[model samples]
Target: MQKKSGLRGIHAGWYAVVCVLVLGLVALVLYGSGAYDSWRDGRSLDQACDGALAQDGLTSALGSSHLKAEDGDDGSLAGCFVKTSPGTGRAVRVTLRWSTDGAPSGSLVWYNADTLGVREQAAPLGNGWSGVVRYDGTWQIMVALDCANQKNKALVAYGDLYGASSGTALTGLGRVTTETAKKAAAQHGCQVKAGKRLTRVSTARLGEPGTAKPLGQAQGSCVALRDVPGAQSGTPEIMEYPADPDAPQTNCYLATSAKKPGYGLYAYYGAAAKDFESVGFGHPGGDYVLATAPCPRSTHEAAFALYRLYDRDTGNYPVPHYSDSFARSALKAFAEHEAEQRGCGEVRIMSAP
Candidate 1:
């Protein structure tokens, strides 16, 4: 009888063990199927930034749909950052910032360094979007959308995409930024005429040793200085982007030879121009050769500057020479052409240094 009791107890124990295993499996299946939705990751893209951002452009760009978001607000600045979940082979981190007074001071400085210098090129985000896109080991974009109702307050978006290439970066980040901007505008009750949807962004070629072409055969904005006597000598090469009045800034680089030191000729508009003028030693018409124009369509004036290239190693000016008067003439031609495109009044060249 005792033996029989022992067998029965063994059967009961085994049954209890099986029941526990099955219950655990059922719980896991319920969670995976979202039956326990409350336990899911709460920080989703739709919930980030009070639902100001969307996953439309980011999913394909980052090659992953499993994303997480974190947002922050610091009175003057607000931002939302999105990234892929851990263990995803496709890694991406994108941050979008919103501000009424333009980008932060540090961002303006970085923009000047990245776009105006010879390191990277800046291209206009076309299709009526007043913004610029650039790439240098990563992608950077800044867009300014005017708000009619919110006078003196334009909705500006600054986006940075890491671990993504040019094609996907431009298309994906550009679309996402535009979408977010429009959404934010609507949510804030700002009357903004959003631009047409963007499928692609312009190409911004980075400066490299083999990319410089002869000044004699230069095209785009560099053509203004192609015939100058100083630029005609030696194997002077030019790195240039086509004139883009839609862009906040434009640039031209002149190199004595391939991979050698050079100088920069650039134009800044809107808040960037204001920032350029406010900083130390960056004032126009004094130490630097510059010109100003009244941009009627924009809230701020436009500035065109000719400045020395900073040494790659030391980050100090090597100060390439050409002739101030000749340079001024070429710059005037360049500025006038751009001003015409922007529908701006008189291009006022600054006094010689």
Candidate 2:
């Protein structure tokens, strides 16, 4: 009987030991099968959250008053706000970058209170890249990844910035102001207007047909020679004459009319002293005149002459003369002035006559 009892106890002990060992094996199998690794592999949520939080901290450090972040798919992050940097006025800037391994590719999208649309992405720079879409008006930006190989993936980062009204990134404000002033002067009649109609003249003092001559000699005693204002700059007004005797004669004469106190330096021409008479005396006929008046300076005089010469040679008025050296110089000055007036960078002259 004693032996049977001892045997039963030992059997019970063995059974208990076997049960404990089986339970330990089950636990080991469960642990090894990755029940915990599923959660570990899915820890991308924690990484994304941490990234967003870190970006917020960085933006705050940069003096951004309003900072916000949002999580996106595949380890992407985005943020936006108004920056407090001085001189930046109500401006918006956006940036996006993404990376991928092997054949990595990604995309970015943005929307504001005004417009919502997918913007075109620029080529990536460095490991990741940043770009600005619009700076002056409303803002939008997008980034993308090149996933050439399906095995590769990407992480996208995006940021938007708004600020106060800052001036343009270009230069030359002074030039623009000066040009505007000049235009205003012209409009106000601070300069003389070019003649709309010409007078014909006939006289001996005038040079032969098709020949250019001095106006002071052509007009003689009929009109007094007077220094025209705005001539100091070498842009003297010229008077042109026809060399033909039988053709309607004309004398070149500078206009002294100054409604706004400006002057036109001009030259006159005639066939004979008598032809010069009508022009100087404001006669109805017998004078031929070509004139350029009320320009900024004499540098443009040669250009004007070349323009007329080109027209005469080509049988076309206002012939374009950009290739000519004289025209180019004048055009350069004009372009600079224009750029100054329009508040733009260096003005480029595409074509001129």
Give me the displacement of residue 148 in model 2, in angstroms.
8.1
Worst 10 residues of 2 by lDDT: 111-120
lDDT of 1 by residue, 1-353 (tens): 99999999999999999999999999999888865543343446667656777567787667676666766443333566776764354433333344335456535554345323465356767777777776656677777666777555566766677674657656888888777777877787767766778887755473665667888777776777776666646328787776656677777777666444366677777655665666632533223467899986556688887765666675544444546765676677668877887898899987567
lDDT of 1: 0.66
Angstrom error of the Cα, residue 7, model 1: value is: 36
Q: For each candidate in turn, give its C-alpha RMSD to the true structure in angstroms.
A: 6.9, 28.4
lDDT score, candidate 1, position 166: 58
**lDDT score at residue 108, model 1, on the 0-100 scale:** 55
Question: Which is the leading candidate under lDDT?
Answer: 1
* Model 2 segments more than 4 A misplaced: 1-132, 145-154, 165-353
How would you encode candidate 2's per-residue C-alpha lDDT over 164-250 as one tens digit per residue?
A: 221221111111112222232233334421111111111112112333333234332112222323322332223333221111111
Residue 227 Cα positional deviation in candidate 1, in Å, after optimal superposition: 4.4
- What TM-score do all the candidates reach, one by one? 0.77, 0.19
Which residue pairs does candidate 1 place in steric collision? none
RMSD of 1: 6.9
Cα error of candidate 2 at position 249, Å = 65
